[model samples]
Target chain A: MATFDLNDEGVVVIVGSGAGGGTVANELAQKGIKSVVLEAGPRFDSSDMVNDEWGAFQKLSWLDKRYSAGGWHGAVNHQNLPAWIVKGYGGSTVHWAGVALRFKEYEFKTRSTYGEIADANIEDWPVSLEEMTPYYEKAEIKMGVTGKTTGMPHLPWNNGFRVLAEGCRRTGRTDYDSGPMAINSIERDGRPACQQIGFCMQGCAIGAKWSTMVTELPQAEDTEYCEIRTGAMALKVEHDDSGKVTGVLYADAEGNQQLQKARVVCVAGNSIESPRLLLNSASAMFPDGLANSSGQVGKNYMVHTTGGVYAAMPEPVHMFRGTSVAGIVGDDVYHDPSRGFSGGFYLEFLSLGLPFMAAFMEPGNTGWGKSVAQGLEQYDHMSGVWVLGEDLAQDQNGVTLHDSEVDQYGLAVPVVAKTPHINDVNMTNYMFETSAQIYEAVGATDVYELPAYPASHNMGTNRMHAEASKGVVNAFGQSHDIANLFVSDGSQFTSSGACNPTLTIVALAIRQAEYIAQEMNAQNI
Target chain B: MNGRLSIDVYQAIADGVSAGADADEANATALKAGLGEVVAQAQALFGSSYVDIPDDDAREGILRTFQNEGFFQGVRWAAYFGIYNNPDVWLKFGYQGSSVEHGDYIDRGFSDITFVPEGPTLEERMAQVKG
Candidate 1:
């Protein structure tokens, strides 16, 4: 591991070594630019990963002090932990299920497509799908996403997916298949093929799934220009008198404070922490936050409108025998305003281990009793689908610093405030009913509707906009107020498209790297 | 009474909560420390004789009363990890433990579905959609 001096002011400092930060670090390193990646969690290799869900969760999940508010179920159920993002060297990419998807063209122009939704702050993305296509191709190829530029075949249909596919067939839905996933179906990129681990969310033990932990971070380290410092929690982004970010003040592993100087600073700490860090860095020059001239740093938070539906088959399905999310039914993933809702959703096959099934099968932790026990007893016969729908961005839903509570690092705890829009409720009801109907069409004995898990696909806090007054960052994720500061994570999402956000995050990072490199050569900072 | 739960008491609670599954056969020592904390909390809430209550209905009622409590959640979560993660319990539930360690079920049974209709091959589907 290469270590750089804290006074190295020429290096770029990237916070949170997840998808965006890790990819940006490697891409910059490949361009011969030195970077210092400060990750808030420990470094763990594939040898440190486990197949057990709770064990892996303890090893990877960000258990920091964060409060939840508003009327979202997570506020009451998962009050202390509103999101399921990781805080490790690779961040949540280590725990991702590898459902790689690109946003549709219509999804990019949501404000124009679904015009004037009540009480929503929707906007069109500054960058369109046409502009993002080449970057998406590069991201897909680099991540070895099956069924895309890699041309590797999609993973085989597991029994759980077969059950869902059969149900979709009976319901006359034609757009369902094993999804385009980043998990390897055939050995490529020097990684082994997925061995049907059934524990993709618990960190792919064999490296078949492409995570920045295994792919980008290690390759960045090999470049000798990139130094990844684990257990370095970024406290604030410090700026000079002229309002340009110059360095980051972070807490080391031993709770000692340190400052690492940088010419450019990129905030890639997911959505919540990215905004929280900016909010925490408030100074006299920038009273609102680092790049909060629009007061939109942490506004318009979104975790895809999500829920789960599990049905019991008469015969054994062994849903846990294969991948956690192997297939997707994209029939409903189009913008069909006729469905009594503006946005669309995807029904992806999901199979949780017994512990999570028992814990999260219902809301508020009341998933006990004889009925719940009976569901667990029929675990082998249960097949399920996770609903991923587009959540309209609303300015009221956001992350804010709490009034009194402070974390272990003495920073004000972030209170994630969110309330499901009526559109979200309507879409979730439609999804649940449609899923139940599909299962019933295939002779399912009983169906159980599971509430949304904690935010996994978190997005949109430091969103991109064409104008400086509308959002915190510009099209290329450069902060509108601070030229040298950037928001490189899902926080830069303009709209919460009805797809997994990791691929979009990677594509945007790749595109941003080129812009950053050009700006550096031109001495723009 | 150092407030530690005994093996027998843990077994009884495990059996009572396992919904008639053979939870007693699973190891309790691994969870002894955590369950002991739960037992201390339960004792503080329902008194020491709560574990010795004769009627199953009464015992279940007490457990249900503390359903949302931390002690109950702790006990239930610990029991779940202890009981469900056991190889014996996995066998009883027909779960094949950790298929990746042995090998993927690709050639064996991943696609040997009897109930579902076979979808078109990936290449065929891609052609139809892209074309």
Candidate 2:
């Protein structure tokens, strides 16, 4: 309701408030570095989270404003359509099912092992897992991630992990391990322990999940130095004659356009809108777009192509009893990598299909009178597992601004042309067979494999590289072309690991925040 | 004799044809006696605007005047009876009728939704249609 201004100490302005922006904001505020965050969604209190499905669906979820479009390639056309996207404080993390796992060490380098891909600009990352391990540790402690490491010989383990491991061992597949998750298993950080009501996709009513609404942004709010302006949609970044970022221009809640000056500007709009902002910031000096001299601003996107397997157990699993992701198995992750595939995959037994969504996918539903009743009867007996594998980097699957269409705010919408490589199919098939075996071992009847696709956990848009000619950002998540501009979301990922991207995004955001703070001190700005 | 010319023309010729007159020669003589004019009058009134025939609703309807009199229904019934005579029409509609639930759109990779072979005859389908 009020017009805003930058804090007096020339605060660093971050453009988003999800895991990446929230993580950096909390770290910056703790270090006594002045920072301000501009978020497009309103701030919601955890107390506002209601229990009923109807109330939760209407009040909390991001189902209304999401858009989709197909992408175009060098000489090919791609389909761009609309989809249900999230808005508000947490961004996609608001509706995320809360699966957390660290990226494997090998995920940082794809080109180094698999060789150059055809018609792709695939490359390795500047930072490795060892460099991010400490930050990952800090994020685990902060977010209260549950589960023991399962794939390798020795990793962290928890109760859920132990049960999955025992189940796997009983079936002669000794590779079942505990999965790491962001939900609060115990009463850590003043958040309540998990009651596991299984409605996390609709927003955790009990604050059991570590969403930004429960985690970092609140800490940022406590620090008076960080000012959070909600409903402030950043249009583009303004630059001075010297190619340095001057300030950002954004539209306010009242549809009034305003500019806020800051010493540095950080864009953390996740993978989709982050590149959209940069591509929109075309100027005389940077005609191809800001910080995009290498022509790699919105290239190298990955989604870890996923499919689901559903089986009917003898008894009702009541999968809605706990968090969405229960456990993971990587027995087939690296077992036969010498078979010529460049990557492995992980499968997690998870809760899927609410009443409405399940009814939509019901196999025997005739959409007539008595048939609808029969479909609802099978809801309790169904349980499913989601298989996520590494999508090798290919330049062909990239995002570009469309020539014709624009958003409601008169900004060009990004047309994403994504086509996963042949290796994606190989990894998906391998994971599918493993899932079928697990179902058979656990004595499941009536197993069905869901369709596969390049889904929405999009990563690696503003990728980080050691050389400026190759990547848009440096290892610290700072733009190599611009001194002060930084990116800390999944956009900075070099390669998508065989795991969910949220936990790793949090780790890298903290790692980058620390780097930014030290850089400010050194410059005495 | 005032405004009309009455010909004892077709009656005399038709009577002769019935009494062993050459039938083809009689037809040719009738055609020569202005039969084209009679057909031209019929075409001028009916042929040009068939699709726009008026119905009970103030707007032009899809069916012609004669079809609106129930001729189309008779033709449909004929087609349905034709299919009823041929049992293979059931398989033509892809209706195996084995565990096939009504309105089930998705097949579990087991069966496809296709035409029922030797299915309902056009006459039977038209009879089933309610007014």
Candidate 3:
């Protein structure tokens, strides 16, 4: 509730209050640094969440004007929606199923380990997994991840996960179980344990799941060091003569523009809007975009090589009875060039409800047939898994401001383009084959290899690297060109590992906050 | 429409096409503005008015041409969700909608799987792998 004046340049202005921005706000507030968090959507507490999938999607999803253009499945089937992230205060964290996974060591060092995957523009992360361990542990602890670090037991298996686990067992794959999740197994942080109510994607109605809405934002507000302005859509970041970001020009709730001055500006507007805002903020000093000296601001976009594999079992599975993402099968979550692909994938339990499956099936997006109806007829008998494979960075695949189109805010609309690499294609095929084998091994009546859905795990638009010449931001997510500006979201990802990204985004935000505080202490920016 | 239950017809077509609420806005706009042109195009393709199409197969063929059209996609998704998200349709799919009110499904068969065997615990699996 503490509000800062427009001329208060002492406070940092953080855009997009999701895992990254919200985490940075809380972490900085805890360090006694003040920040003004601007969320483009209205804030919602856990009680305001919806259990209906369509209802929550209508309420929380990012419905801004953007276009998808590429050869990928998303372009053909879902041309308007390349990335399906949330827009509310908690961002995608509100909608995320509590799958808290850490990147493997090799995942960070993909360039060295995978070594020349033809067209893949892979690079080693500036911060290695060894350096990130403590931060990862901190993030896990902060989110109350149910794993070895927290001493909280993994969530119990549901009928959907049991089907996949049995299939994994039958297929000789072992690293399968109800894995480390951020949802409460036993009430520890005042939030009740997950009651197995199942609508995790529809924003966790019971607050058992860790969302910045229920955790970071409220905590940051309580510290009296943060002022959160909901429905404040950032139009552009204005900079001083020295190329230092001085303030952000954003449209307030009433659609009138206001300038909130900043000591430092952090862009955590996920991948699309983060890059789009930077591009929109282009000036006479930085024509290409703010902090785009290397032309890497909106380059190398990667939405984890993803797909869904659902099987129609003989018996009823009732996949929607528990947590949405039930468990993970991580046998494939390692590097193996011998498999004709550079990186690996994980088969996580996924159970799409009747409405979703029917819709996404698109009747094959090819023919209007009875086949889809037959599949939906077996809704209770369905069990599924989502494939999260490592997607390589391609400079050709990124976000670009559309040539002539402007959105509701009158800013140029962002056009996200993706072209999967040969490695991605080969790896996806391997995923389908293996997933189909697993399902068929456990007596699946029919297996469906669905095309990729609108990506929820988007990364690498304002990527991190060791050197300024190679990337936009440094390891701390501080922009190389604009010292006072930072990228504190999955947008700064150097590479996309084959896992969920919220934990890593949180860990990086915490780490970046520490760096920002230290730099402030030293009067660096 | 094709001798199937009225609900099954929507499932056969598609749903979730209008995932974003903005898409719904655009779709609603297109539904009003583009319907006339779509009918005209359908008429030209079918050699008759859209409602006067003689056969389902011919009607489907004309529909295929406008598959990517804004009006077509909008109307289809709107119609599909109308039926599928309906409370009456929930019984057909055995969907237990919004269980938080009755409490979480922890005891109400969230873990119940009759066909699949109960697997070993995570500890047991780790121990076995170590061995």
Local distance difference test, each candidate: 0.86, 0.63, 0.87
- How does candidate 2 score on lDDT? 0.63
Clashing pairs in 3: A359-B15
Sort all candidates by DockQ, best to worst. Answer: 3, 1, 2
Residue A427's C-alpha lDDT in candidate 2? Answer: 69
Of the two candidates 1 and 3, the one with more favorable DockQ, higher being better, is: 3
- Residue A392 miss distance in model 2 (angstroms): 1.6
Model 1 error, position A277 (Å): 0.4
Model 2 residue A112 CA deviation in Å: 1.9
Residues forming the 10-long window of minimal summed lDDT in candidate 3 chain B: B122-131
Give me candidate 1's interface root-mean-square deviation.
5.1
lDDT of 1: 0.86
Question: How many steric clashes does model 2 contain?
Answer: 41
Interface RMSD of each: 5.1, 27.9, 4.3
lDDT of 1 at A145: 89
* Superior by TM-score: candidate 1 or candidate 2: 1
Top model by TM-score, which number? 3
How do the residues A1-525 of candidate 2 rate in per-residue lDDT, one tens digit apiece? 122365333778889888888888888988877777888767776556543344554565434222343331211211232222356777667767677777777677777766766655668889888998888888877777764321111112322233334446656875554335677655667887665455566677678788887778878778766778888889999888988888888987777877878788889987777887899999999898889988889888777767776665544444434555656787656524565466778877665434322323322212212233233344445556788888766777667887887776778877666665777766667667767776656566656665442244778889999999888999988998899888888888888878888898889888888888888989933
